[model samples]
Target: MSEANIDIQLLDDVMNKTVVSVEESKEKIFEIAENAHKENNFITLELETLRNEIDLVITQTDELEWKAKQARQRLANISRGFKRYSELEIREAYEMASQMQIQLSLSRDKEKHLRERRDELERRHRNILNTIEKSENLISQMGIVLNYLQGDLRKVGIALESAHHHQLLGIQIIQAQEEERKRVARDIHDGPAQSMANVALRSEIVEKMLNQNRIDEAKVELRLLKELTRASLVDVRKIIFDLRPMALDDLGLTPTLRKYLEEYEKRHHIETKLTLLSPERRLQSSIEVAVFRLIQESLNNTAKHANAKQVEVKLEFKPNKVLFMVADNGIGFEKQAKGERPQFGIMGMQERVKLLQGTMKIESKPGKGTILFFGIPLRIEENTKAGGSEK
Candidate 1:
């Protein structure tokens, strides 16, 4: 062949190889993007599921805690009645206390296991999120390269953009998860752990009193120990409930909110009222949880920052949506002031509403109290079944 013909043949061969390589790269990038998306979604679901499990375990711990208190109270009463009561009664009290102690041990073990599982799931979630970010970055780079090639690379660019958006969302979710985990850890350390330490000290006091042959004093000390145990159990249950309320699952939203509000009022001495304009109907589990957490966080803020005494929570069901409003008669801050921006709690609530494809509004002034309104779209199918059972 002539030299010119040979040059043309060589050019054609090079072009063919380049085309093949580009096709292969495109395929690989698409595969990675698909897999990363799937993995990220799976991780998100798994994290949510893990959270639910943790909530259930915490609730069980709370019940066991209450049972422990009852046992302690019985034991204390029996000790008081020993001088005037039957041997059978005393024996029964001891048996009850022993059973309660065993139950308490099992509950603590379950809680520990749940915490470990939460940590593991959190770590896995973080790793998957990081992987998604890297995968998106690689896809973006591939998109840039594909732009220089011939024929229909726009789809790859779109895919790259979509992946980037998902990666950002994943990052946001991970940040929220981390914040929640930190909050829970702080609560456990400050509330339950401290209370437990106090209980231990009280128990030691009772032991020393008995050792000194002070039966009457030891009885008094034991009474004190019983009270301390009850209080500690309450603290632990509050911590656990704050993490997740089983009532949200068992009693649906309205009853759960009522119970929480009642408890909140009793705890903070803040007069609270819950008004339900909508018929008692169940919502999607995710929606129920989000609404519950939103209200919980809002009330917590009210209790902590709001100097007001009365809080009102309202739930309304519309034809195609559900609306939640938490109005607190507190010293509301300036919603528009640059120095008075929304805090993490408010932002977290907003994030949750957004996840449900909802809109949230906060209305507050310096002294007019604060009112938060958020509306979430609801599908007709979501109102299908009620939750498990009433708490």
Candidate 2:
């Protein structure tokens, strides 16, 4: 029993066991198919996500490109600023150089003018120094030649003075000679002429008497009056000849002086003396005239102012000089007071002497005889420049 039943149970148990195995196999196959389907859906979702991520990446790239363009514009602006700054620096430097050149030219012109002024001042200084030196040399040489020359000049002056003094003596003698001639003429006209007229009247009377009837008396008287009249006519002719003698001009000064003196003494009945010392042959005409004029003035003064009875005349001629004097024993005047006007004769004589570049001296005392002395130079024209010479 047990075997058959036990075999059967064992088979059954084997069948059930096979059945459970088939079920498990089916569940596994279904599970595998479902898992495969879920896997496929997940793969499709992942593909869609990848497409969206690609779009986001495109937007970010566009933003980065825009930033790069802005950076390029900023660089261009910086370059332009640097270029403008360089141009301004160059223009300012050029203007500064031009101003320096103008200042240098003005300084050169001032230097040239200063140099010319300095040269002119130096020339004037040298000329002034030369003039001062020449003046000093002339003043240093004036002291050595004074005394000997002065003595010689004084001697010459004295000789001239003496000649001037003596010059008038000739004129005085001439004047005295003329006075004698005048006295003679007067005596003849007044005394002898009237006597002859009386004699002529008596002769006419005698002739009338003879005609009437007294012949003898008439003849005697007539003869005597005729003889006297003839004699007087002859004397008158002789006086005419004596009035201007040729010897006065031709024979020289001394002869004329002697002739004049003799005539003066005879006529005036006064004492007059003459003294002559030097020979006189020839002299300058002006000098001769000066001597004569001096003599004439002296005699005139004596005659007019000095009531003298006696006059002495002296003429002396010496080497380089001539002197003459007229001295009268007459009452003299007092010496003139200061500032007194000159007397006419004295002034005339002084002027004559001065004209010949000479001097005159007069000496007199009150109640004493008056003396006039004149001196002159014989050759004044030859030695000095006096006005009397015609040349």
Candidate 3:
């Protein structure tokens, strides 16, 4: 064959292979995007169902709260009139109080479970949306290359590079998700699950006392049960809020952060100070969530690893951007190379900032404390500004 013919055949072979690889990559991405869209829809329906369940539980809780309050008042009145009442009347009063206490405790537990379910559903929904966005972006980038290449030899190299980048991103996302799942599972086992088990054991003890005709002892057990249940309810609510703070939706970012830091300090026994430099204003929902998670992860890391006595967080709102910093006075460690074993918390924070087209920097030394700084541009919509003013 002529040299020209040989060259043309070689070029044709390369083009065919490149086109095949591009098509396969496109198909894979489209599959991912479609699955993500379906998951998003499923999560939306689940969230709606969860919200209805939560509303119902809230109504029931309110009723129980009222009834419990009334029962307590009746018990107090009975105590004052005990000298004038018969033995049966006093026993009946105590019995009524015990029943009311048990009922209220059960109702509160149910409400707590419902709220946790709702929060988990919401988190899943956010994750699905993120996956969809990433898949769509990858597909769009490939389309641009496909349009511009027109069978060029370099198309193969570019397509391969794109595919590799997408693969790495997918791995990173999966790793982050797994890490999150582990954290949540650990928290549930240690916090609410343990609390619930204790409640069950106490309830059993109360039942045994009542069966043995130890009315007075049973009454005391009931009282202890009430306190334990109330405390457990608080713990469960805190877990749910940490999973996804409702204040982030109702009160906006600044208020939510302030409230969270206050709780964090009390819980961790680490003095935490928050400074807000901007006039309290709301940002887009996505940005608000990202910023909240960034700070949350930062403080969590500090609590677990820093052993610091105090941590400082600051937020500054700019005309077209927002900046955040989390600093801790604790034993620091050597910074590892980016390619080293991943620090999941730090990596997750970096990924969140990257998604917002923002910048993140971490500074640490063996003796000095660690500092994390991130900034992201904000597009202040008219409606957002108006909403801020209302707040």
Candidate 4:
């Protein structure tokens, strides 16, 4: 085999081993969570039984106290009238009082023991619940890792092969892709996953409340759960829009940009204006997506690092090219080597424009706002001409 083939084979072997290791770990965690859940259920039932036993013991003790009081009174009366009562009567009365007192003491002790057991069980149940939650979260994270390895990360080999001449750029792209995946995973876990878990728990609570005939409380819980579901839906939709705005395909670029900027201004509390120098028209899908991303990234930078109060965007469509500009009145900094978090956005924007065979320019300085401009060549539609090409 050639050296490249050998290298590819080695990468495959390494990935397979890594995946196996992760899968094994995930299985172990799942097993642990299941066991913990079972243990919690058992503890719950035990606690219920213990509480009932304690209640019974309390009733018995209360009755014993009354009987012991009567026995004491009878013994005292017999003792006071020693000449009128037989010795057997007095002795019997005294014994009865002593026995009643002993029974009361024993009953009270039983109640105490049952209560302690109930408390212990409750503590164990809570700990088991926490364990189950942690184990479940770990399992979910491992699944994300497995998906990344088996799905998108697999593209690394193809990227390396295709960009052999640009190894560093390929690696940077891979890193960016990995970071994006991590971010998406984090957002899902924190937003939708947590909301769904709460929804499940709340639904269970509502069911229990209704079963117990707590109509008012169940209504309140149901309302809260509905709100949570709504919030989760909104979060899910926002994440989807971030990934790819469907409106870009349906309504074209101008409406999409206008809607996006208006929402952005509302969300970030920044002023934004959009001016179209030429009438809106559909470009190629690739160009549309690229341009949208460029604007999106610029606005994100402005929000995160620019501390901008107002931003303006301009778009101009010509016969053979499109022009775009974003100017922000924010705190800008001196440009230097790109190695920081703030610089990563700019770097990504530049790479995106480069992929579209476009030119991008950035002008910024300390105490000055930032302005970004782009000129992207438009490609003729294949259906429009037999030899359609980029202009």
Candidate 5:
């Protein structure tokens, strides 16, 4: 039942077999001490083995801590990588949006410019159309005028032919008169004028000799001949210059006029002034010639008819036109007096202007000076050059 009772019985049995004594008990105790020492030794060995196991566990725990830190660093790196990628995507998106906005602005600007250009072109087109309409109306009126003039001329021609046979005779008479004037002028220059120059040369030599008291009678002839030669040359030069102006052929309208006006001033003692703004640009050759002739005719009329002290001639450029104005303080015309001879100069000027489709205006009264205006409508040429596209 108990370890003590079992042990007493085992000892009593051992004693029956052999008498038990203190010496044996002592021996048994010694043996027990020896077994206890061995058991303690085994316990010490087990403790050392347990301590080694604990040290192994500690090393394992340290390895686990290191692995945990490495996992955290990897996670942080992944997160940062994600954040950087997101930032790059955002910047790219923003830049793309900015580029799109710039493109849109440029497109809008271009569209606005195109719209303005279109409007300007349309406005110009409308103006050109209006100008054309006005021109057509004016042309129609001119056509009526031309037709009326043609009819009047025909009626006048028939009446004159029937009633006035001497009309042709008068024309021939005027031509004969002109030819006679030319012949006289030519004869004066060739015959008497040349003879006078020869006489003048001889007179100069005779006069020089006479100054030395040689040939008194010959010196008297020489003096007379020299005076005659000078007078003849002056008269001949004046007449020839008036009849045929060399300046007219040599120079254009303005230059010829300048030289002619100078001569007019010297001859008539009239202060004729001129001012020109534009250089003489090239014109149709016929137009230039016609203009020159017209001015010449107008000036002749002024000199003959006008009792004016001063004359002002101005040529100016106008839009689609050119203006030539001759103003003078002179005896004015009486339009009411139909009996007076028509100023052939005025009528001729009007006819010439008509050929050019130009307008001529004459402003005059009893006291006031005559202002002859020759307004040339250069619109045809201007329109042609402009392609009729500018109003």
Candidate 6:
């Protein structure tokens, strides 16, 4: 056999083995997730039982307390009037008070024990739920890896040995793409798909109302269905826009950004300002997209974690590079603290800028705010080589 043929055979064999190993690991993780789910369910039931027991014990303790109080009052009265009561009655009253006190103490102890157990079980349940979530996430990530290995990685085997850095970058790109696809899928499922289902159900209800000669009820249902369908359309358009904003192509970067910021401010109720330091013009398509995404991610982070009420975005069109900045008056985070890395969103933004041969800087502190800066080169030839032109 030719050398090339032999190499191909070896590569195929290696890939097959790797795929099998990944599959086995995925199965094991799936089992762990399944077990964690079962444990979470069991803990939930135990928590319910413990709660009921604690309530019952509390009621019993309250009853014992009342009885003990009554017994103590009776004993005090009998001792004060010793000559009017028999010796047997006094002894009985004293014993009754002592017994009631003991019962109340025991009931309280049992209640305390049951409450402690319930608290422990609740903690365990939370831990188990976390475990289950982590396991499921791991399984999903493994599936992405497995798909990459089985499909795209196999095709890239010949180039792998030659372009090691390129291979790593390619993997990152693939993972990002997969993550984006998952986000789109989730948005559709939770938004438009659900709305459509509700619309269908409501349409049926409207039809029944019309058949029953309930004209007013039918009109109300029809109005609701129309509103739902309108909302569904809006959700779908938003998803499509997220995928690729047509405005970016038609109106160019600045206008697109202005419109986006307007909508974002309205939606998040955060005051946002956009300042253009240079003449408004378009950069390379790649640079424009990257800038938009970086800003979008920064804004999202601010909304999600910053607790900021106001944000400022600045853009400068330089002779050779475009400068972008986003600053927020939010509760910022420590940069590279003792053992923590930058958040994944920031890391991803940095990667995107790096891929475009750009520079990025982030400044943040605990009580202060955060500021991110990007300087992207406007080299036509290089950007075209990296990402195609607008046309």
Best by lDDT: 6
lDDT of each: 0.75, 0.57, 0.79, 0.82, 0.60, 0.84
Pairs of residues at least 3 apart in sequence or in different chains that clash in candidate 4: none
Residue 369 in model 5: lDDT: 79
TM-score of each: 0.53, 0.35, 0.49, 0.55, 0.39, 0.64
Question: Which candidate has the highest TM-score of all?
Answer: 6
Total clashes for model 1 = 0
Tell me, what's the RMSD of every candidate?
21.2, 78.6, 18.8, 9.7, 63.7, 9.2
Comparing 2 and 6 by TM-score, which wins?
6
Q: What's the candidate order when arranged by decreasing TM-score?
A: 6, 4, 1, 3, 5, 2
**TM-score of predicted model 2?**
0.35
> On residues 178-209, what C-alpha lDDT tens digit does candidate 1 reach at each position?
55765776677567655665565556657866
Which candidate do you rate higher for TM-score, 1 or 6?
6
Cα error, residue 43 of model 5, in Å, equals: 99
**Per-residue lDDT for 121-150 in model 4, tens only?**
888988897897688768766866776677
Candidate 2: clashing residue pairs, number: 18
> After superposing candidate 4, which stretches have Cα over 4 Å from the reference?
1-163, 166-176, 204-215, 305-307, 318-321, 333-344, 365-367, 377-391
Output the TM-score of candidate 3.
0.49
